[model samples]
Target chain A: MALPLVIDIAIGQLRRRKRQSIVSIMGVALGVGFFIAVASLMQGFQQYFVSQVIDIAPHIVIKDEFRTPAVQPAVAAFAEGAVAVRGVKPRDEIRGIRDARGKLAALEAVPGLAAAPTLRGPVILRYGARDHSVALVGVEPERERRVTNIEKDMIAGRLEDLRATANGVILGIGAADRLGAGVGDIITAVSPRGVAVTMKVVGLFSTGLTALDQGEGYALLKTVQILQQRPNVVNSIRIRLADITQAEPLARVIEARFGYRTESWEETNSNILSLFIIQNAIMYSVTGAILLVAAFGIYNIISTVVHEKTRDIAILKSLGFTEGDIARIFSVQGFVVGAIGAALGCLLGWALIEMLAAIRFDFNNPVLRGQRGFIMSRSALPFIFAGGFALVSASAASILPARRAARLNPVDIVRGAA
Target chain B: MSAPPLLEARGVTRILPGEGFGAPPVRLVEDIDLTVGAGEFVAITGPSGSGKSSLLYLLGLLDRPSAGAVLIDGEDTGALSAPALARLRLARLGFVFQFHFLLPEFTTLENVMIPMRRLGRHPQDEIRERARAILASLGLQDAERKLPEQLSGGMRQRVAVARALANDPEIVLADEPTGNLDTRNAATVFDVFARIVGEHGRSVIVVTHDLDLAARAGRRVHLVDGRIVSDGPHSPVVPQAVA
Candidate 1:
C-alpha cells in the first residue's frame, strides 16, 4: 500500500530535478538504441549468409572418402602399436560408392530426410574452338531439387527438361557467358576417363556465387556415369533435412551407419560460423560497454538526488518511515526512468532501422555488387534484449544511492538544523 | 499504575564510537529514566551537549539504546527489528524535530500526509481530508498547497506539528521544536502542545532549553550529563487538569 506513496514521492523528486533526470534518460536511450541498431544489422548479414548457404548448398554431403586413412593389416598384426610398415604399397582404391542406390533408398525411408546421389568428376568444355576446364555434376533432376535450389536458380530451360533429354546439360550463367552458348546449343564435354561426348545445353542458372557460376556444369546422372566409364557409381550423396540445424547430428548418424565420410554444412563452414560467434561476442560487449557508461550517468544523477534529499530522508525517518521505504522510493524512481528510456530507445531503434534500410549503399563492391540497401533484420529479439539490459542497469545503479539514503541518521541531521 | 506510562525510558543509554583510537567511548545518554503519562505535558530541559535531543530520539524510537529499553504503552522495544520498531513508532508515537524538517519537494499538505500514508490505514481521499482538516485546525488551510519554502518560519513549525499529529499517535515527542521560532511563535507552539495534551488526552513530551516555556508545562525533567537532575510537578494545579 505504501508503494504508491513511495512512487509518488520518487516521481515528485524526479520531476523536481527534471534536467538531471532527462539527461540520464537520454544517456540510457542512446545506449539501448544503438545496441538494437547494430544488432539488427549484424544479425541481418549473418542470416543472409546462412540462407545463402542453406539454399544453394546441401545440408550434408556424404562423400566416397574416409576421415581417417585405413591402417595396414601388417601394422596391426604385430609390433604393439609402434610398428611402421615400410614400402608396403596398397592396391588401387575404388573412388565411388558401390551401393549408392541402396544407400539412397535407405535415406528416403528416414523421416524428414531427402538424398540425391551425384557422379561428380572433372571435365573440359569445348565449344566452337574454345576449351574451358570445369567440374561436371550428374544429378537426377527431381531428387536434386529436393537437395538443392538448382530448380529455383534456373533462368533458362526447366531442370525437369533434363529428364527427357538423356545428354542434356545445365551451365551456370558465367559458364554460358564464357561459352557464348544458350539453350539448345551443342557443347563437347571430355570426361576424366578421356571419353568425349556432345551434350545439348538445357538450362542456365545464376546462384550469385562467382566460383559456382563460372566453374561448374550439371548433366543427367546416367549420362555422366556412362561418359566417365564408372557405370552406376556415385561419388557424392547430398542430403537435405527438414531442419537445417539437425544436419550435424543426422550426418554423424549416417556416417556411423555407413562407413562414409559425412560432413554437415556447419562443419564445412565452421570457420565462417566461428567468425559469426566472434562477431556476436564483440557486438554484445560493445553494447554492454555503452550501457555501463550510461549506468554511470544514472549513478551520478541518483547520487545527487540522495545528497539533495538528505533532509527529507531524515524527516521521513523521524516520521517512522522504515529504511526499506526510503530505499524503495529511490529504486522506484530508477524503474520509472529506465522503463521510459527503454521504450523511447526501442522506438528510436526501430525508426533508425527503417532509415538505415531505406538508405542505399551503391559502392559497386564485388561481394555486394547488386545489393541496393542495407540488410536490416526485423527481429524483435534485439529490442527485447536492449530493454531488459537497460532495466537491469538502472536498477543496479540505484542500489548504492538508496543504501546511502537509508543509512542517514536522523539525530545527526536534526542536530545540525538546531 | 495509571494505565502505564504512554512513553517510558528505563535506564536508557546510547554510546557512540570514540573520536580517537583507544579513547573512552562517548556516551550521548546514560541511564536516563523518564515517563510521560496520558494527557500529561512534560518538558525535558538541559544545556547544550547534555543529551536532551539524544534522549528524545531514544524515547521516539528513532535511535536504539546501548544498554536499556524504551517502552511504548508498556511494550519493551529493545528486541524489535528495525522495521517493527518503525511500525510501532508509526502506530503509537510521533516526532517533531527542531528544524521542522519537511520534505521540500512536497507541498505542506503532502508533507503532513506522508506519515498517514506510511501508516496505510486510510484511503487517499480520507487521508487528504484528514490532512486538510489538520492543516485547517492549525490555521493553515490556505497554505496547504504551498511548498515548505513558501511558508513562514512559524507556519512551517506549525505544519511540522500538524504532520507529527497525522497518525493520531498516543505520544507526540518533540525535540526543541520551537528552537528556531520567535517568541510569539514559540508561545503558540507551546500552546498547541498544551491543547494536544489537555483537549485531546494525548501525552506530549518536549525537549527545549527555554526555561520559561519549561516552567509552564505540568512537569519538567532537568538533565545534566545524561542523568536526570530533577523531575516533578511545576505547580500545585496540574496543567492538563486546568485546561
Candidate 2:
C-alpha cells in the first residue's frame, strides 16, 4: 500500500543531494560506456578478419591425399598385432584423385554446393635471360570462378581469355613485374621433366598477399597436364557451400564418401579463433573492474545518505513505516541511478563508436597493405550486457547501507533519550 | 458500567543493561499497571529518572515489555507479529516527541500526510485534502507549504501534532511534546492536546515534569524509582484546561 510513498521518499532524498547523485551516476556511465565501445570494436575486428578469410578461400578444400600416410601391406596384413617391418621404406607414390570423373559426378548430388577440380605442379618461368620458380596451377576458368574470388581480383585480362587461347597463362602482378612481362607476351614454361613449352601471358591478378602474388602462375588444365607429364589427373577440388558455418560437417561427409583428406575453413583457423576467446575474457575483466569501481561510488553516496538521514528513518518508523519499507526506499534510489546511467552510457558508447569508425588508418605492412579503420559492431548485445552488469553492481552496492538504515532503533532516536 | 479502556498496560517492565562488567541491569519501569479510557486526558509526572517517559513508551508499544503484556482495545498486543504490531500502531496509535521531528525535507503538509500515506486508507487527492484540512485547523494554513526549517518553533510543533493526528488514532501518546517550547508555545501546545481529547473524543497520555501542567489533567500518575507512587483521579476538577 505504501510502496509508492517509500519509493517517493527515496527519490526525494536523492534529489535533495543533487551533486552527490550526479557524481555516482557519471561513474556508472563511464564504466558502461567503455565496456560497450571496447567490446563492439573487438567484435568488429574479429568479424572483419573472418570475412576476409572466407571471401578469399573456399569454405572447404578436398585434396586427393590423406593427412596421414597409409601403412604398408605387411602392416595391414598383421591386423591386431604389432608387426616389426625393419628396413622397409614407404613407397614413393604419385598423388592424384584415383577416379576424378566418377567423384565429380557423385559430388553433383550434393545440394547448394559448387566444386572445382585443379591440377597443381612445380614449374619454372623463363622470360629473356631471367627465370623464376613458381607453382603452376591448372584450373577450369568458369568452374573456378564459382568456388573462389580469383575472378574478382583480376587486374588486367579476364579468366575467360584463357579458354580462347589454348596455351595461354596468367601471371600474378608481382611475377609479371619481375619478368617484365605484359599481356600477349610469350613466355617459356619449363616443366619439371625439362620439357619446355611457350605460352602467351593473357591475364594478371593481385590479392594483397605477397606469398600468393609472387609464387603462383595460372594456365589451362590441359597445358599443365601436358607439362607435368601427368594425363587426366586432378590433385585437389575446392568446394563452396551456401552456408559457410556448415563447412565442417559438409567437409566431414565429403571426406567420408571420397576416402580423401578434406579441410574446412574453421579447422584451418582454429588457432586464431581460440585467440579471440582469450581477447574476450581479457576485455570483460578490464571492463568489469571499471563497473566495480562505479559500484563503490554508489556505495559511498548511499552510506552517507543512510548516516545523515538517521533521524528521518526513526521518525518514519514511529509513524508505523516498517523496516522493509525503509530498506526499499534506499534500494529504489540505487536502481534509479543505475538505470539512468546505463541509458546515457549506451548513447555515449554509440557516439564513440561512430566517431572512431570515421577515422581511417592505413596499414603499411608489405604482406597485407590496405586501408584500415576502427570497425564498430552494430549488434545490440554489447549495450544489453553493459546495462545488466551495471544493475547488478548497483544493487549489490546498496544492500549493506539499506540494512543499516532498517536496523535503527526508533525509541533511542525519537527524543534522543539514549 | 463504563466501556473498557482503549489502552491498557498490565504489570509491564523494562530493564536496561548496566555499563560495567558483572553489574546488574537497571530497571527503568517495574511491574506497573495502568489504563487509559477513550476521551481521557491523563498525565504521567515525575522528576528526572523516575521512569515516566519509559512507562509512556511501553504503553505506546514503541518498546516491548520484558515480563508482561499490553492490550489495545482488548487485543493482546504481545501475540501480534512485528509487522502486525506496526500496522496496529499505524491504524490505532499516534506519537508526539519532545522535539518536532518533522522530516525537514518535506513541507508541513507532507509531514502530516506521511502517516495517512503509510496507512493507505485514502487516495492521493483525499490524502492531500485531509492533510491540508489538518494544517488549516491548527492555524497553519499559510505555513503548510513551508519546510520545517522555515517555520517558527511553535509552528513546527503544531505541524508535528497535525502529523500525529493524521490517521485519527484512538490514543495519542506524547513524550514531553512541549519540553522544548517557551511558556507561550507550551500553553498553545497544551491547548491543542486538550481539544484533541475534549472535542475529538480521542485519549491523550502525556509525560511531563511540569506540575502546573500535570495538575490540569483529569487523572495523574506519578512515578518514583521505577514504581507508581500515586495513581488516581484528582478530586475537584481543576478548571485550568488550557483552552
Candidate 3:
C-alpha cells in the first residue's frame, strides 16, 4: 500500500477518537515540557557554580612539597634488599621551592599560561587591642594580577600600591573588619618565627569564599620574606591557563618535570562536581519516568482504538491490506501524535523557563546578593533531548497495539459478525 | 472447459483448535470441493452452523485450509506467502460482509476509493473519478460526501458493493451482503450483485440464508453440517446470461 493512504487512514482513525487523541498528546507534551524546564534549571546553576570556581581559583597550583619523600643513597644503591637500611638521619632543608625563578620562567614561556610565585605563612595582625590570625601570602604585584582575580576584587586601594608604597599590605575585607582597620592603617604583624613588622594596609578585597575572606592577606614578596625570616624563598607557583580544561594534563606535566606536587581545580573541587552528577541523574530519571507515564496514555488510547475498530480492521484485511500495512497505519497515528506533541512541548518549555526567570527571590543572604531571579539555561540541548525522548517513548508505546491489530484474523471477525 | 475456473477449492478442510490441553479440535468445514467460473453468480445457502461463511472465506483466501489447497486462476495458493496472498487478493478479488462495514470515518466516496488507492495502480485523480463513477453506477452519486451513518441501510450496502468493485477484481465474495436489510433493500443489494456479474463480467459468490435470494443466482450450492448437500441450478433451468 502507498504510504500516503496509510497515513490518511491513520489520521482518519485518530480523528474518530478526537478527545482521546488530544488527551494523549497533551500528556506527552507536559512530560517533555517539564523535562526541559527541570534540566535547564539544574544545568544553569551548575554552570554558574563552575564558572565562579574557574574565575576565582587558579587553574593549576604547584606546591613546594614533593610528591614522594627522598630516598637514602644506600637504599638506591643496594641490590634488592641485600642491605637493609634503617633509621637514616635526614638532612635539614628550607621549606620552599628551590629554583622558583627558573621554574616560573619555564612555565611563562609556554603559550596561553600565566605563572606567579607566592610565599605563604601564618601571622597575627594586632590592631588596637584586638588580634586576628591570618595566612599572609607574599606576591609580586604585577605577576599576581595575571594569575588571580585580586585586582578585580579590590574595593579600595589598588594592587599596584604594594610596589609603590614601602611595607604596604592588602587585607581581606573580612580580616580587616575583625581587626578594625582600613587602608593606610599602620598595624603590627607578628610571624610565627617571632619576627615582627609594622605594615601599612593598602587595599581591601573580598572573594566571597568565607575561608579566604576571613583569614588571608597579601603583601609584597620582599616584606613577607623578611617578616617570615625566610628571605629569597617562594613556597608556591600558581598557574592560570587560557583553556581551564587543560589544567589536569598541564598539572601532571609540571609535576613530572619539577618533582613537586600539583593540583588542578577539578581535583580540588571533585566533591562538588560529583554531586552535580547525582543531581543530573536524578533529574533525568524523574523526567524519564514522567515520559513513560505519558507513553502509557498513548498505549491506552491505541489499545482502545484497536478494540473498538475490530470490524474495520477485518474489513481492511479482506480488502487486501497486508499485516505490515496494517501495522504501519496504526504506527503512523503514534508518530503523528508524538511529532505534534514534541513541537508543542518545546514551546511550552520555553514559556516555563521564561516564567521561572521572571520570578524574583527576596532574601538578604550575601551568597545570593547579586542574583535577581532564578538561574535558567537557554541552550537548545535540553529542548532537543526532551522532545526526542518523548517521541521515542510515544512511538514505542504504540507498537504493541499495532502488532495486535495487525495479527487479527479477518475470518474470525467476519464470521463472528455474521 | 472453456477456461479454467476463476476459483477452485480441492477437498478443503478447516479445524478450529480446542481451548484446553488434550482437547479434540472441532471442524468448521470438511471435505468441501467447489469451483466458481468467471461471470457466474453463485449463492451459498445453509442453515445456522452449517459453515456457509467458512466456505466463502476459504474461496476468498481469507482463511487457510488445513487439509487441501485453493487455487486462483489455476495457480495453487497453498505455497504462496501471506504477503503474496494479500497482493493476489488486492489484484484479483474483493469482499463484502454481512454488516455494512464501511469505515465509519470516511465518506461514501473515500470508502469506495480505498481499494483502488491500496492497489496504487492509477493516479489519485483517476482513482477519485473512477470511485465516483462506481458510486454513480450503484445509484449513490448523491451520497458521495455523506458518512456511512448518514445513509440508509440499502445505500450503505450499495456503497459496500461499490467499494468491492473499486479495483475491478475478477471475483467479488460477499458473506450475507443483505442479511440485515428489509425486503426492498435486500432486493436492491441482490440487484447490484446481479449487475456486477452480468454487466461487468465479474464472478460473485454470496452466502445467504434466504432461499428466495438464492433462487435468483445462476447457480446455487447448499451446505449442511460443513458438507455440500446439493450443487445445481435452483430452478428447473439455469438462468440465461444477460447480454
Candidate 4:
C-alpha cells in the first residue's frame, strides 16, 4: 500500500480515539520537559562551580616536595637484599625549590604557558595591639599577574604598587578590616623565625571565598623572603596554561622534569568533581524513571487500540494489506505521537528554564555568594537528548501491539463476525 | 468451458483444531471440488452449520486448506508465501461479508478507494475516479461522502459492493452479503450482483440461505454437513429475476 494512505488510516484511527491519544502524548511531553529542565539546572551549577575553581587558583601548582621520599644511601647500595632499616636522623636542609629561576625561565619558553614563583609562610599581623594571624604569600607583581586572577580581584589598589612602595603588602578586605587597616596603613608582620617587618598595605582585594578573604595576604617576594629569614628562596611555582583541560597532562610533564610534587586543578578538587558524577547519576535516573512511566502510558493506549481495531485489522488483511503494512500503520501512530510530544516538550522546557532563571534566593551562603538566581545552562544538548529518548521509548512501546495486530487471523474474525 | 476457469478448488478440506488435550478436530469442509468461470454467478446454499461459508472462504483464499490446492488463473496457490498470496488477492480477488465491514471512520468513498489504493496499479486521481464511478454505478453517488454509520443497511452493503469492484478484480466472493437486509434490500443486492456479472462480465460466488435468491443464479451448489450434495443450474422461481 502507498505510505500516504497508510498514514491517513493511522491518523484517522488516532482521531477516533482522541482523548486517549492526547493523554499519552501529555505523558511523554511531561517526561521530556522535566528531563531537559533538570539537566539544565544541574549542568549549570556544575559548570559554574568548575569555572570558579579554575579562575580562583592556578591551573597547575608545583610545590617544593617530593611525591615519594628520597631513598636512603644504605638502601640504594643494597639493591638486591631485603634489608630492614630503622628511622635515621634526617639532614637539616631548608625546604625550598632549588634553582627556581632556571626552572621558571624554561617554563616561560614553552608556548601558551605562564609561570610565577612564590614563597608562603605563617605570619602575625599587629596594628595598635590587635593581632591577626594570616598566611603571607610573596609574589613578583609582573609574573603573578600572568598566573593568577588576584590582580582582577583587587578592589582598591594595583598589585604593581607593591613594586613602587618599599616593603609593601596587599591584604584581603576581610583581613584588613580585622586589622583596622586601609591602603597606606603600616602594619607589623612578625614571621615565625622572629623576623619582624613593618610594611605599608598597598592594596585590598576580595575573592568572595571566606578562607581567602579572611586569612591571606600578598607582598613582594623580596620582602617576604626577608621577613621569613630566607632571602632569595621561593617554595612554590604557579603555572597557568592557555587550555585549562591540558592541566593534568602538563602537570605530569612538569613534575617529571623538575622532580617536584605537581597538582592539577582537577586533582586539587577531585572530591567535588566526583560529587558531580553522583549528581549526574541522580539526574539521569530520575528523568529516565519519568520517561519509563510515560512509555507505559503509550503502551496502554496502543494495546487498547489494537484490541479495539481487531475487526478493522481483519478487514484490512482481507483487502490485501500485508503484515508489514499493518505493522507500519500502527507504528506510525506511535511515532507521530512521540514527535508531537517532543516538540511541545521543548517549548515547555524552555518556559520552565526561563521561570527558574527568574526565581531569586535571599540566602547568603558562601558557595552561592554572588549568584542572584538559579544558574541554568541554555544549551541544545538537553533538548536533543530528551526528545530522542522519548521518541525511541514511544516507538519501542508500540512494537508489541503492532506485532499483535499484524498476527491476527482474518478468517477467524470474519467467521466470528458471521 | 473453453477458456480456463477464473478460480478452481480441488478436493479442498479445512479442519478446525479441537480444544487442548487430544479432542477430535471438526472438519469445516470436506473434499469440496468447485470451478468458477468468467461472467458466471454461482450461489452456495445450505442449512445452518453446513459449511457453505467455509467452502467459500477456502475458494477465496481467506483460509488455508488442510488438503488439496486452490488455483487462481491456473496457478497453484498452495506453495505461494503469505505475502505472495496477499499480492495475488490484491491484484485479482475481492471479498464481501454479511456485515458490510466498512471502516466506520472513513466516508463511503474513501472505503471504496481502499482496495484500489492498496493495489496501487493506478494513480491516485485515477483511483478516486474509479471509486466514484463504481459507487455511482451502484447508485451510491449521493451517499459517497457519508460515513457507514450514517447509511442504511442496504446502502452500506452496496457501498461494500462498490469497494469490492474498486480494484476491478476478476472474481468477487461474498458470504451472506444480504443476510442482514430486508426482502426489498436483498432483492436490490441481488440486482447489483446480476449487474456485476451481466455488465462487467465478472464472476461472483455468493453464499446465501435464501432459496429464492439461489434459484436466480446461473449455477447453485448445495452443501449438507461440509459436503456438496448437489451442483447444477437452478430454474428461477420468478422467471424475470434471472435477468
| Alpha-carbon lDDT, every model | 0.88, 0.86, 0.89, 0.90
Quick one: best lDDT, which candidate?
Answer: 4
Please give the ranking of all candidate structures by DockQ, highest first, separated by commas. Answer: 3, 4, 1, 2
DockQ, every prediction: 0.59, 0.51, 0.67, 0.61
Name the lDDT of candidate 2. Answer: 0.86
TM-score of chain A of 4: 0.93
**What is the per-residue lDDT of model 3 for residues A1-418, given as tens digits with 9 covering 90 to 100?**
2448999999999999899999999999998999899999999888887877787778898898987887778878874777777887767678999899999999999999999999999999999999999999999989998998988878899999999888999999999999999998999999999999999999999877667878999999999999999999999999999988799999999899998999999988999999999999999999989889989988898899889989999999999999999988888888888888888888989999999989988874444436777789899999889899888888898899999999999988987887
Better of 2 and 4 by lDDT: 4
lDDT string for model 1 (A56-155, tens) is 9999999999888887898768758778678887787668986999999999999998999999988899899888877889999889999999888788
Query: What TM-score against the true fold does each predicted structure earn?
Result: 0.92, 0.90, 0.94, 0.94
For model 4, the stretches where C-alpha displacement exceeds 4 angstroms are A1-3, A124-133, A173-190, B1-3, B235-243
**Model 1 reaches what TM-score against the true structure?**
0.92
Please give the ranking of all candidate structures by TM-score, highest first, separated by commas: 3, 4, 1, 2
For each model in turn, which proportion of the native inter-chain contacts is also found? 0.81, 0.60, 0.81, 0.64
The all-Cα superposition gives candidate 1 an RMSD in Å to the true structure of 3.9
What digit string (tens of lDDT, one per residue) describes model 1 on residues B1-243?
557667788999999899898988999989988878888888888777889888988888888999988887788989899989889888878888888888888899999998998898999899999999999988899998899999999999999999999999888999888888999999999988998988899988899888789887889887778888778885332233110
Least well predicted 10-residue stretch by lDDT in candidate 3 chain B: B234-243
lDDT for each residue of candidate 2 in B1-243, tens digit (9 for 90 to 100): 766568888898899888799998989999998888899999998777889888888888878888888988877899888778889889988898888888877888888988999899999899999999988888999998899999999899899999999999889988998888888888888898899999999999999867678777889988888898788777332332222
Candidate with best TM-score: 3
Query: If the candidates were sorted by their lDDT against the true structure, best first, what order would they fall in?
Result: 4, 3, 1, 2
